[model samples]
Target: MASENVKLEPLGPNKTGPNRIQDDGIDDYDPHLHREVESPTTNAETLIHLLKGCLGTGILALPEAFKYSGMANGIVSTFLIGLLCTYCLHVLVRAQYVICKKLKVALLTYPESMKIACEIGPTCLRRFAPYAPAITNFFLIFYQLGICCVYIVFVGKNIKAVADEYTTNDISLTLYILMFFVPFVAIICIKNLKLLAPFSILANLITLVTFGVVGYYVCQNLPPFSSLPSFGTLFNYPLYFGTTLFSLQAVGVVIALENNMATPKQFRGAFGVLNIGMTLVTIIYVGMAMMGYWKYGDKIESSITLNFPPGDVLAKVIRIMYSIAIYISYGLQGYVPVQIIWSNYMAKSLDNSSRKSLYEYMLRIGCVVLTFLLAITVPLLGLFISLVGAFCLSALGIAFPAIIELCAYWPDRLGPGRWILWKDIGLIIVGIVGLCAGSYSCIYEIVRSLASGQT
Candidate 1:
């Protein structure tokens, strides 16, 4: 908690909204005012917190995604999409930083971040600014729930194997996963976002473990991956496309953290960290996907662990760890959007004449309920990725920041900097084009899968 005397600085009318505090320069921000919110840990703690939360349940499904996209193409696409995602997150970071600095109020909450930004310029722009976070949060809750459910399912399957009991096998795996929500709900009940930081750090470490586990098997199975050079896309391409997108989804998670960072000035260092982390992820994706598919060829399941001999203790152990890791990651991921909605609902309830205190509680219960429902209905893994990525993330992750940046800092502000403006507008335009076109292809593929009666 910050000191009550600590105040947010304000900006000119061009920056702050009509309702905002007038700038007097009297209330300078103590940039370190919120340091108590974090432990003595430095920006590395923040960076890892951002990266690990982003990587969540996606790790379990990434190899499967690669199989959907194809081999060479998927490997290539992983790096390409990661870079593009890094760019999108960078835009959001810039937008949030620029807006927050202008407003002088720290983005202590999600809505506070956006509201402060929109105050920088026009009214209509302000109105639209909140959409991205809202939509992102809506999808994230389900995404997180799905991951946790997967973890629960993994537990049941393993426990059933060991116990040699519970003979009733008629229940759906998804339903069994729902049963764990009683416990998961208890976990989500905790209110502090920063409190999850240590867990997120563990998630990143688990990610490293998963990477190493996969890498070890990959290296030992080197003969199969020798086919990389001969790999051509036309046929093997769709085999691994999905993982490319999965590899980069964490970058969107970065945007959620970027808004909450204590020091906006440290953004450059954060972006550098982000790029390096994504590069590592890309390499791991390429290594795992190329090796797994090349090894098994047509017999490969979406997940390599599945394709491994079932009774092998090593493989089972890896699968268990992998599943647990995804499960924890998703649980953390769910918190990102829930916190945003919870914050906004709390902020608005200040004058909405409603059950203000209860809204926060409602947010927790709603997350558990929604996630449980999703796990049951949309049991298919492919469908989950499509729904989360194309419908939710495409606009929120790809299109929204570009729109905000163009609207917030364009046309006049460049001051004869048409060259720079055109360059950015071109990049933004490219991202928008990619969003529409790529999302169409992904949705088309998902629709085709549904039509074909495939999961």
Candidate 2:
């Protein structure tokens, strides 16, 4: 007999063993036992990666997010969004585990999980299983490309800030973006993950130092709370929703991190890596938003780094360092979409071609150019962040997970009294509303900015 802890017991003999699943319908499969990761990541290592994933360009935009929602509202709403995002992440992972156990698979990517869940779900959804992976990949690819575009704008704007100090001539942000094109292409062309690992490490370290310096500046000369509004106008709340969602949700990498764990089971539960990491992330985000907003008040820039005094030598150094950090991250961020486009769609066609390597390099350069064009077209960082967050993450981070959970559990196993069903429904509704409202607000802002002759 299988252990009591096992959710499903296999029929006949050959039970109570790792990676053992009989021909019968029953399954005593434990995903953890079956995993064959050659170099599994420890819990602490996974936590660090989680932190690095969540703490990207989004963190720098939270204060501006606060600018949209007001300090008090921003604090409260950000925490709530963090909670929601965390819960959704838990939902997705739990569903993945359940589906993996049923399928007797050691691991499944986000799209794979969605596809398998839909295949085994309620009768109505089984037919849609074929399309799930493509849809999921669509969101994943779009979100990653959106991130690359943000990095482009972020690096360009920071470099522009530093150069504006040295020269009185007004250089277009487009020119600065163009200046870094070759370097961006050079870094993106490096296909070896091992080579890129060092750059990722350096970027994380630089980000930490940048945040520390930013904290120092924001902490000094704090403004009184009475000067700022407790709640912003309703018109701007969607922008806040989008930015906070963008900042708090790192759904793209959650499954990847969980799948690579040395002990995958330690990724969830009360004190699991997910909870602890997200708690610290939420706290950091809230602290940055509150402090940055309080310090700069209405004068806060899209990135808190920009709000730093330009004349200060330290501020210039910080800007340059952060620009370098984000520039490095562009390659890391761009890697995802490139892989999805090439391996999933293009590589099969060129399997026997001698110039396959040549095509891949061209694809990489093409992605850089695509993001460059997008960055130059809508150079506004805050609006672009909001749009991407609202449009892409809303679906990937929130709605799709809820839908996946619903399908994975199906007609039964939806918790006592079907509470999970209702809860998932609520999440799906929230995601949809956030997507629509946030996207609208961002587009409106972009159009208004254009009309006002602002970049």
The number of clashing residue pairs in each candidate reads 16, 0
Residue 68 error, candidate 2, Å: 0.9
Q: Candidate 1 lDDT, tens digit per residue, 201-275? A: 665676677667666664565455544444444433332333345445654456544434555356445456566
Off by over 4 Å in 1: 1-15, 18-40, 108-171, 192-206, 220-243, 251-271, 346-362, 415-455
Candidate 2 — what's its lDDT? 0.86
Please give the range of 10 consecutive residues that has the lowest summed lDDT in model 1: 1-10
Residue 220 shift from truth in candidate 2, angstroms: 1.4
Query: Cα RMSDs of all predictions?
Result: 5.5, 5.0
Task: Estimate the TM-score of every prediction.
Answer: 0.74, 0.94
lDDT score of residue 327 within candidate 1: 49
How many pairs of residues collide in model 1? 16
